[model samples]
Target chain A: MNKGLLIVLSGPSGVGKGTVCSVLRKKMPDLVYSVSATTRSPRQGEIDGVNYFFKTREQFQEMMACDALLEHAEYVGNCYGTPRDFVERTLAGGQDVILEIEVQGALKVKEKFPEGVFIFLVPPSLDELKQRITGRGTETQDTINHRMTVAEEEMNLLSHYDYAVVNDEIEAACHRIESIITAEHCKASKYLAELGELPAAIEKA
Target chain B: MNKGLLIVLSGPSGVGKGTVCSVLRKKMPDLVYSVSATTRSPRQGEIDGVNYFFKTREQFQEMMACDALLEHAEYVGNCYGTPRDFVERTLAGGQDVILEIEVQGALKVKEKFPEGVFIFLVPPSLDELKQRITGRGTETQDTINHRMTVAEEEMNLLSHYDYAVVNDEIEAACHRIESIITAEHCKASKYLAELGELPAAIEKA
Candidate 1:
């Protein structure tokens, strides 16, 4: 059986990546969301292995040393990473996995798994992004401004993505992503590995 | 607007490329079917330009010399070729064009237009293919055997295609091709050329 796709949805903060992911999950119930393993203590209601694979500092480092994580990063005093074993197992089982992560983390994942389909979700425009960010009453002017700068930098890295979807509307973006997934499956490279093992024998027959 | 996609449908002679294309046309009414220019004398009710470009031998040679033909071949002392202008014009106008041709001609078209989306349609199996050819009921045993040999050779070239869709059922095959088209549009390379110019200026903003 063909392995499922590792679709990485990456974008800057407040670009609505989470909303898009949530919508996508509803649209595609079979899609598995990747759970990260982190050394950071879980907040209230966060479950180990579900919310995250709660790991000790030593355990996280060991995973890193063994190359057991697809991508890992240290934030503040805690380490966070996606477990490679779970992803590989799920994909091998022919179930697609959606990995929603920051732009930086997504690039790291690409280095480890170049075959992964990288999608960079962008807002329709800088002004729209600012508006969306500002719509959040919690953010102060400085925080919003800081995010705008970061978003611009992230947009510059758009060239690295397999597809750059404009998050103009949630449903539209999700539809486009679905089409992209369908197309990816149709791509020759997706099935060539399986076919590569058969052509010689089949031709002889 | 982004330029249109050049979708090339190819496969073995009896694999029902024409049937799939016909169904696809009804489904996607906007898809332009490429018309070949042929030097053969027009048969009854074969309208010029509508059915074929109806070129003379001298005109066909000029097209070949100028690289104006995407792919050209001679059979039974008559020449036939796909005009490069019609395909290019249709694509540049942001309208997708579908080229239904033999596996050999599709490969030739790829040599000229590397960006063309080459799809190979195949029967479910060799036995299925033989059954389909025999169902035509017009060929003698020798002709059927010869065609089977030729088809097997063509199937060997399957690796060259960007996508290989099984023609188990006409509707199912059409659906697969439609999904492939949707995915091709979502590909990053499709829009990167237009996006390339913007990142520099947008980054400065």
Candidate 2:
């Protein structure tokens, strides 16, 4: 059996990343969504190590200091980071791990774990993205405009990704992601070790 | 629409490349199987262009001289070559073209068209490969040994391929190939142009 892939799926705000991921999970139930350790207090109904790995600032900092986190970021007064141990164990157990993060965090993860399959999810068009953002009805017009600007910046970073999936339709996007994972498992890099053992296997045969 | 991929599907003898390709073509009716120009006389029921672009030795040599053939080789007494024009036109029309060729010809195609996706098809095991070859019942023991030797040589060239599909089950192998084609379309190289147009399209929106 092949080792599971470390898939980093990132997109700009309001590209339906969460919805797409939900659908993807239904298709690939074995996929492990990485839970990040955060210093912020967990909201109601959020389970420990499920929604987020709730941690104190001291614990988060200790994790960072010990290089236990794959990537960490400080946002507004809280430190949030993906724990390396969970990801490694999941991958070792032959279960694919998905890290859903923003572009900045995705790039940070890329720097630390370059072999992870980095996927950038995009909307069919900017108009659709703006519409989706507006449909949320939680943000002010000014905030929406700021997000659009940020999205523009994020689009520039698409070159850094290995694959770009367009969220035109939920099912189509999910299918593309699933296919990407299946295809990635067939990549030469993933099979190199097995290939190295081929001569011995053949000799015995 | 994205331009179609030039996919080179290669395997050692008796790996079921043809059966796999036929099933794949049934699933992907739009896929164009490349027609090679050959100097050998066509067997009964072989159409001129459908089976092969049957050409005289002189005509095949002319194509080779004019760089019209992507890859070509002389085997036994006859010459065989992939018609570059047919492949280019098919891809330009946004239809994927599959070139089922031997390893040497595949390597030649790779040199000529580096962007082409090279896929190596393999059996589940070398014993299975030998069993399939002997199961054909057409080869002498010496010829079977020679073929096994060639298969070993071909396996060594696995490093040159982009992906490897194990032919344990035909549907599973075909599905993997289909997934590979889908995932490759999502690659950054293929989407860079769309990503470039993103800003302009967003501004217009």
Candidate 3:
């Protein structure tokens, strides 16, 4: 059986990445969403294993030391990482695995697995992204402005990724992501080595 | 607006390409089957432009002289070729064009338009291909054997093509082809370029 592909999705805050991922998960049931292992305590209603693999700081540090994590980073003094074993097991079962990580973690994952498909999602316009951040009403104006500036820096790295989807509309963005997954399977490099062996086998037989 | 993609199909005889192309055309109306131009006289009920752009030997030679033909070859003293003008016009109109041509013509078209997706349709197995060819009972045993030999040669050239679809089941083959076309549109080369100008445009306004 063909192993499932690894797909990494990264985008700036307020780009509707979560909404797109939700719709995509509903459409593709077999998809495996990689839940991060975090040292931070779970908030209300957050399941331990289902929401995250809530680990102790020592446990997280040990995993990082042993190279057990595909990617890990400390954010605001809390450690978050993707467990490599779970991802490998899911991919071995011929089911696609989606990693929703930040730009830094995404790049780290790609360095380890060069074949992983990296997708960068973008808002339709910078103004629109600002409007979205402000509309949330949770962040102060200063915080929103800071995120908008950070988003511009992230957009500069868009050219480094494999493909970019404009998260202007939820359905359309999901469709583009689905199409990207389908298309990556059609790559010649994936089958060329197998095809090369066929001719030799035929000749030997 | 983004122009439609062009796809070229090539395979040895008895590979079930005709059935695959027929099903694909019905499934994708946006896919336009390119009609070839020929120096051979039209058979009864064959319409001009629809069936073929019937041309005299001199006219065909003139097209070759002016580089009007994308690809051309002579078989049994009759000439057949694809006109570049008609294909470009169709693609410019936002319709995906498919050329069901032989391997030689397919290669030529690839050289002229490197972006054109080339698909090679193969049988499930060499033995299966021979069985289908012999089952037809329209050709002599010697002819069937010769075709099987030719099929092997074509398989050797499979690496030169972009994708290979095994025609074990008609519907399955069509689905693979459709998936390939859908996927090609999501190529990093194509999608990333669109993102390039968007950021600059958004920042300017």
- Candidate 2 residue-wise lDDT at B174: 96
lDDT by residue for model 1 (A141-177), tens: 9888888888888877888998888899999999888
| Candidate 2 colliding pairs | none
Please, what are the lDDT tens digits per residue for candidate 2 over residues B84-170?
888988898888999987777899999988999999998888899999999988778998998888888888888899998889999
Model 3 chain A lDDT-worst window of ten: A187-196
- Candidate closer to the true structure by DockQ (higher is better), 1 or 3: 1
Ranking under DockQ, best-scoring first? 2, 1, 3
Q: Judged by DockQ, which candidate is best?
A: 2
After superposition, the stretches of candidate 1 with alpha carbons farther than 4 Å from their true spots are A38-68, A74-80, A198-205, B38-68, B74-80, B200-205
Cα lDDT tens digits for candidate 3, A3-40? 78999988777787767887898988878999889998
Calculate DockQ per candidate and list them.
0.50, 0.73, 0.42
**Per-residue error (Å), model 1, residue B142:** 3.0
What TM-score would each prediction reach against the true structure? 0.85, 0.91, 0.85
Poorly placed runs, candidate 3 (over 4 Å): A39-46, A55-59, A74-79, A200-205, B38-48, B51-59, B74-79, B135-140, B195-198
**lDDT (0-100) at residue B72 of candidate 3?**
94
